[model samples]
Target: MLSVALGFAGPALAWPQSLREGLFGSRPSDGRQFAAPPIARYVSEDGDVFTLDRTQPRPLLKFDNSFEVWALTPQPAPRGDTIYKNDLGEPVLRATRLGGITIFTEQRPGGSAAALAGVGSPLRLAIMGPQALLERLAQASARASRAARRLIPFEAEATPASSALIADSAMITSEAVVRMTKRADSRHFLDRILKVRLVEGRKASAQVAQGVLEVTVAPPQGLAGRPSSDRIVQVAETFR
Candidate 1:
């Protein structure tokens, strides 16, 4: 019987008369009309979906796998706690800042549980200034080149620093590193054939401070002759 309340505010701007009538309903005979309250919905990590519609006493509706109605509860979450809602605006998670770490709780049936349940290991990354960050990127690229050579044994001898960097940055996967190296080789070949100067796109950037780290990877801008665009990757995490 877990219940969560989400307060939805009214629309900020006024709509045109025709559009307003369609959304808020027609004017009543008494010359008074009441706008419909906004509805909020959310899906749990376990895949439970529910919606909350504003009423005199708010009601929550849960749906099952077959889209059938499940449990309905009227319980509201404790005040002062910030509830993180889903795209539908229904509260699915709550977080509170403690001394160091932020505790996130997921709202579910029967009871609430820690959102970061299986995450026990502390993730750490070196803090680097602008120059160091650039140097690291260059070092990483050099390592990837050496690793690529390992794929084809006769090219060049792999460097010890490249091997060490690959082993240390467990944040990045070996497969991703290999893929990057392959792309680098392909770019080189394309440049040789097309005779066009193509710069290597910025792959990733990371910053760590005060136990919080943020990483961003720019979208891949494909080879010179063959242009391609991929989605950007961004991640923010907290560590001990």
Candidate 2:
């Protein structure tokens, strides 16, 4: 289990304001780089523990027995939501601000512990306050509601070459379809489903028939590296 220490001064001070100040504020009053106490602590699967401190203008990671520190700068979120990606460009660490509290998730490649131990790997910790946890649960509930309401069912045969299921419908954008197929191919079955549920949310639906896969999706919302309609359409047509 991972533990987090939120440096809250008092109950009167809102967490969002404090979190922003800690993450993006100037040096502390004492002129030291890091705060007196760390904001969070993470224990890797290898049993190595790390700490995150809000040191002047950025966050710093410190490990036991190592004087060296890895500084992390905030990166812009892809969709400009409360969710933010780290500087690594991969979804290493995602910090999401709900209302008062913030939520953090550690995203490792293939969700492997060894991969998480790589140099500059994001901290594998989930720090959630009561409000933050409630926010997540609410968002999840909303997604489930939307999925139940808008799900579309269909049937199509799987292509022999790629084993990709094909569904032909103008209602689904080519980019959305192709991206969904690629996601299905690349990730584990459960992971693929969860990814779609989180990203597409109410925007798309997918299911499999006897020997085929079926999908229904709304227009593309410009996910990273999504191809143009012409190219995606061409690829989708080839499946049949």
Candidate 3:
């Protein structure tokens, strides 16, 4: 159903309508500005739809069939085309100056061509129902707790009381917990975290202390005023 095929010359990468809400911001408040990163939806040669959003230092990759997001960085490529890579330094996407794209994969080491599917929303937090936030918080907590083999309760505090941005930040924080525990390198960090706490701010930040994972979310920064899912995981990262 959802397959990443093709070669280098025919690179295909796309984001979905769900991905248009992301706006450019920071990896962690570094104050670096990204040149106009496209926030557009695209269809691959193989017919898979993907989305791209660069509301932070890194771009976020999305697919239509699933909600899983992968963060990528734009790099200078040959002949003016740009290559997008994950933190692991793997080339995941390439784009031509004229809006053509190539997504690299094991099946298609060369590439594939992609076309603009349609216009997408400007980078912002997605308009989610309040009920969805509550459900996401509960589900993220339950899943993270199960993965950690301990209860890692997720909670949030917002200044305006009704700011959906803050609520979205909290939701992102909760999702970050899920992301953190899923990685082998970070899974052990959750062993010491008894709870994950989120609060509103102008930039996303986190600290692990006293058995608590404290995350401060930028209300109008990152993706939709909350840190992107991967940024929160990076913020909550432990050196120990």
Top of the candidates by TM-score: 3
The residue pairs found clashing in candidate 2 are none
The positional error of residue 218 in candidate 2, measured at the CA in angstroms, is: 49
At residue 149, candidate 1 shows an lDDT of 59
Best by lDDT: 3
Which scores higher on TM-score, 2 or 3?
Answer: 3
Question: 1 or 2, which is superior by lDDT?
Answer: 2
lDDT of 3 by residue, 170-206 (tens): 5555666666767888876656678877777666556
TM-score of each: 0.20, 0.23, 0.60
Name the lDDT of candidate 2: 0.32
Q: What TM-score, to 2 decimals, does candidate 2 have? A: 0.23
Instruction: Please give, for residues 1-240, the per-residue lDDT of candidate 1 as tens digits.
Output: 111111222233333244334223455678654333334333334544333342322232323222111112222345434354332243443433220112122333333332121111111122334344334344434544455453221111113322222222311322233443446433332122111111212543333344222233232311111111111011111112
Better model by lDDT: candidate 2 vs candidate 3: 3
Residue pair clashes in candidate 1: none
RMSD of each: 20.8, 18.2, 10.8
lDDT of 2 by residue, 27-105 (tens): 5677654322325543444445445544334454545433223335566554443222333333333432211113233
Task: Give the total clashing residue pairs for model 3.
Answer: 30
